[model samples]
Target: MESLPHQYSVSVNAEKENELETTAPHLPTLLVAPPSQFDGPGDKWSPEELLLAAVANCYVLSFRTVAGIAKLDWLHIECTTDGVLNKVERNMLFTDIVTKVTLIVAEESLRPKAEKLLKKAEQVCLVSNSLLSTKHLEIEVVVGG
Candidate 1:
């Protein structure tokens, strides 16, 4: 297996009168709701954004960890994640999430190593692992040297 099995969990608390002010143990209190386009508060973080953030964040961290293990060094790595939400049947669901990973290396010889690490990162990201098959994920890796 590429990764070992692991378990993680978090607890959230919200008062009856204030659902927006939800807080989790060991985490900051955040206002949760739908996107502003759906009449939700514009100033708060929406669930969709949170989901995509998790994927993007996980990919970057995974890449770093893999690169460290592989002894591959790069100047920088940038990942842009986008989620496509569409109406399916009677519910709105995310049909696809696309992540574009760009890697910059000081030497041309590191390009192949960077690409390999980036692809491994996309495959090993925990957030992407948790997603169902219905949610399609596409990852693109671009290496610059």
Candidate 2:
């Protein structure tokens, strides 16, 4: 049988006054509804923005994680994500998320490996994978330095 890869779980709990709390492997918070400017006070992040930020942040973090695991030295890193919401078919809601990962390495030969690492990171990124199967997702990796 194939062995299991590294795994973890995140949990979210709701508390008083329409507030939500996230726990376990969760890297971010779940703000209460009404949404700051819309009504009540909460974090400045919206649910949609939260999703994008999570995916983008997770991709970059995953890359660094793998790079460290692979014992590769790196320099600068930047990740950008754009989510486009459009109508699918008639009224169906859809989203297309595109991510650009730019990595600055110490040597030119590391470009290929950098791309490989970024790809692997994408495959394993929990948020990215979740969104990929749900909607159209594309990623581009550019290496420099």
Candidate 3:
């Protein structure tokens, strides 16, 4: 079977002054990362940090898409993600990512609908599926406060 949508690119250049390009004409910048907090070597973002962000960002995008598909109207949305890095097998690498999504809807009645959107978001989350084990997702729907 073939994927429905195809053709996408994210270009990153260490020597290009943190410049990038995206095939999606609608997208402005490809994406930017300030490298690691520890500045010693490696001119690019660390693999672990990239993994964490990828999972995080992918879910957020997925959530938004799902919300629109499910007819969910929201005022604000915030999310946080965590990846547990450890040594698996003989080499050291990432283990899993846990994403927490906080959704604020326009009205209290939309909370349940928002929750359903989150579920669909998880389903289309490509980053989550790339991982090996289950990635724990914590979703919260807040009405006003």
Q: Name the candidate that leads on lDDT.
A: 1
Clashes (candidate 2): 0
lDDT of 1 by residue, 1-145 (tens): 3476755565555566443665655777787765788886667788889899998999899998999999986778778888888888998888888887777777777777777778888778888888863434444444554
True-structure RMSD, every candidate: 3.4, 4.9, 4.5
Q: Candidate 1: TM-score?
A: 0.81
* Descending-lDDT candidate ranking: 1, 3, 2
Write the number of the candidate with greater TM-score, choosing between 1 and 2.
Answer: 1
Better of 1 and 2 by lDDT: 1
True-structure lDDT of candidate 3 = 0.74
C-alpha-based local distance difference test score of model 2: 0.69
- TM-score per model over all chains: 0.81, 0.63, 0.72
Clash counts per candidate, in order, are 0, 0, 0
Summarize candidate 2's per-residue lDDT along 1-145 as a digit string, tens digits: 2577867786756666656665565366655354464575656455556678888899888888899888777787788887765667786233577887777788777777877887888877878887643533344444454
Q: State in Å the error of residue 111, model 3.
A: 1.1
